[model samples]
Target: MPESATYALDTRGERMDALEQYFREAARELREPGLALDADPDAVHRFLHLPAVRLQQHMLTPARYARHDDVLPSFVPAEASCAEWILAAEWLAYGDPGMTLASPGPALSTVVLRALADEAQQDWFFGRTSDWPTWAFFALTEPEKGSAATELTARLDADPSGEGWVLSGEKMYIGNGAHARVGVVFCRRATGPWGIEAVMVDTGDPGFHAETLPIIGLRGARISRLRFDGMRIPPERVLGRHRPRSRRGLQGALQAMLWFRPSVAAFALGVGRAACDYVLEQRPALAGAGRAEVDGMIDRLNRLRRLLRDVAAEIDAGSPNTFRVSGVKMRAARLAEDATLLAARLLGPASLVEHPWLDKAYRDVRAFEFMEGTGNIHRRGVFQGLLRDDYFTSRDRDVRPGRVAEGVV
Candidate 1:
């Protein structure tokens, strides 16, 4: 590596070290809610300005979001190595699952909107809004579907004018949907077949509307359902190229979204690690608890952390292993389940109690599996990848932590 590259790596190392310290301090802050003060809405909003537990959360949540964003640029940058970025994400999730869960909101999706938007629209968007506050409903999911981007079938027949198109369909299980400014709705063109092109619809359009969906878990995320009633959108909304019976528009957007699946997993690992940290400090308290169980749990968490780190390192090094990203995501999700279950056992009835960080971590981290293409889906992707001709020899496939499989949408 060049001296500049070496400097960048060192800088990232330092930044990650600092970020870890910040995460630890923030966790400490959450551990003491007497310090988390001003739960009052307006006061809480006001409190976010000052440097406190919540403020630390504010920074950390965005940091996790940025970690996902940072990976989108093909390689890790100087600020955060893939490893550090993943750790930061986990810490953020661990801090306040709600806040962390609410993250990926505007930051991750906006990167796609910015990349795919036409020049005029891009200029208009960036010129007016310095930072887009978007939590995408990712309109590909439907009430009864096989749950693939190709399964998304919102009609995308543009009006005769070509200036606008009408999108008519229902989108379910959108993240941060209750009150997000920007929305990316994927709809199939009216003139196409089953797996046709996707037009990225802007939610601000007249006929577009969004309603929240009540979900079993992740209450803090404000999951939503979207309905497009003759929603007229401009041509600039089409995000990717066209294909036979398929919309590649989602390809790019999905690139923007799915590329970070591993990062989401990394975020989960952080939560698991934090929960383990919290439990280990008080391991001797329980009646039947022994050092063996506690030590075993810690070892498991550490292993998960290392797993997350290895995938991140590979992606950063641009030599990601085959389906390694999926493996990491799957492992992280399982570890989260284990960590949360262990936390419940470690904390006893206190796991369900409020005013503490553990329960929120457990709740918030659960979104990891659901949001980033469920664990099983990615696993299947991994399985299919193992069978592909491109799987073994492609230079891109060599990326030990290459992006989640594409061309699915």
Candidate 2:
């Protein structure tokens, strides 16, 4: 039997329910402070430490390896399905955006390392470390460079003796940037198709610097701007093969994002779901246009959730389905933004002035649009996929190997 079929667990739903309760309880105890968002940096650090420990104890490591048939080891979520992962993420997002925000840094780091790093490197980085949970992050966005890898300005220059490499650059909007023990920093090498290379940087290194950047939402998150004046690391710190003939570095980054984008959508979905639930509870009080808007948002959110599940199924079955992934991500971002706005509108002045939850959720949901890719970028990707022949025709429509022209026939 295939590995996907082999690992199917009948107990997944029960397990998820228990996990959800644990998360909800944790969120209640660790509820975000309203008055001063980032007031206590020490407290915010303490808040994440215990939860990280608990997650490690529960074997909640974001990515794990499983046998892909006895011949290959695959980075499938060892404890749950991709769909279940999304469900859990949704609850986390709803319960506490701050905790939800903390998760992606480690998760994204795991995904990128699994896809790019060698077996030895992966073990050394992700394997059992100290008693405390080891936090890691992926640093791709730069101070000046936008999302485009080709525009990467981070410098990765080799040492003259070839013993190591020196890194000098700044990364922006990096989650856990200030707190993470380790991070994968994407930089441009003088050589390479795109001059793109990813190097693992130790945040504790003397030359590495991190300053927290306060944001409108997810205030508890330790997002920071990382500056590497002269960070140095051994050659092994560089992930993937160095030889041009065997290069797969950038491709690995793309593959990693394909695995992660759904979780991004789930984060957005959770915010939207929270809005939907709140509005539904208040539906009796609402009349006319308010009620109709709530009804419309509920319908829209339900369809978006189903679309997310379908994309997750394809991922679980080991097909990344880039087109569907991009489509769902694009749709989910818009839906979350719209639903949160509508919910706030339905709640009237109370949402903004009297209560901070929905207002906070509104700001948090906006992060999804820029997380994996902006909505406009994903829309373009989805459109391009639709234009591909194989997306609908099963084969290239423009040129066929053995078929004659339809008009000639």
Candidate 3:
């Protein structure tokens, strides 16, 4: 690696620390002010700017790794697993999910670019991107297409003149749709309706329009609609042109799953953690050893956190085992819901819509179920990967990979 490349990798870690401290301070302020239940933008930005969180954001922040030009350890040291990434997210997210959403584009994009893009493209995507903040979303969702990565309408037409590609169609429920300068947009290419390709789209160009949709939860976070009006692309941005047969296309799809589903769980974890803390803080008597339900919640959360950490370690080591990560996603989202509901139940009817934390957390938790391929989609991803072993029963098999679970428990 060049001196600049080495330095950038080193700086990424440093930034993570700095961003982490920033969140610590923000959390401190929230507690002191007794703020309006996660409704502060300044606080959200502070949380976004945390060292751990900011590094997470910058990785995929560009015209799209989106660091575009930097080199990362093909395998992270044993010390830095996916857990470190998700764990840090867990902490910051606990304070505010709205704030925490920004960190992921970096983690997911960096991992994918390093794994997919060619050295030249990867170098440009990473090394050249401005430290100036760029937000991106995995724009695979469509109004008609929910969890199917293969079902998005955003079509990519690759110009055969050895020139570029054109992406047409739109995406909905896109996080950071309005402000995102670039995106990891998935499209059904013109080769066939069956031909699917994931391309990076620049929102600055003509024919590209993104309008954020109004959402009930995570109101501070930008969620929008994207319409690609004959969006043009150059050969340089072709992310998967040299698609490696074994893991290239499939892995990228899995990578998208890896980032968001657990994130859904992470979002839930934040609410659950806050809810538990709220319950413990509000009722001082439960400090005793025999906190059965509280202990159970803690146990479930700890296990899920461990799963996140272990799987992240695998991804960092360049040895991604989606089965393990998918399990974590399953457990995380479910337990998070249970954890939050437990708190709500313990707090009673008035607490369901109560002030400060519970009510907002309850709403945020709902988005987790729908975001990032949804719980049912992940269940399929997990089952497929695990059932690759074939020891599992055929009866559990879903119609389209797996079932789309609805009506959050």
Give lDDT per model, in order: 0.54, 0.66, 0.60
TM-score of 1: 0.72
Per-prediction TM-score, please?
0.72, 0.80, 0.75
Worst 10 residues of 1 by lDDT: 34-43
Give the alpha carbon lDDT tens digit for every residue of 289-384 in model 3.
425788778876775665565566666677766665566666677777787788777777788656546776777777776766566766786678
lDDT string, candidate 1, 1-409, tens digits: 0112322334656756655665555444332332232122112222232222222222322232332232122222223445655665666566554444444234344445443555654444333223423334345577776346666667877587767677788878776554555566666664333444545545666777787665544454566777888887676656544233332555545554544676677667667766776776655464455446656766766765665576677766767664657766776777777877777776667666842565555666677787666878777766776776433335445545634242111
TM-score of 3: 0.75
Model 3: CA > 4 A from native: 1-55, 58-81, 102-107, 127-129, 158-162, 190-194, 243-250, 287-291, 381-409
The candidates, ranked best first by lDDT, are: 2, 3, 1
How far in Å is the alpha carbon of 94 misplaced in model 2? 1.2
lDDT of 2 by residue, 16-74 (tens): 55555554444444335422343443354455343422332223342343212332113
> Who wins the TM-score comparison?
2
Question: Which scores higher on TM-score, 2 or 3?
Answer: 2
Per-prediction backbone clash count:
17, 0, 24
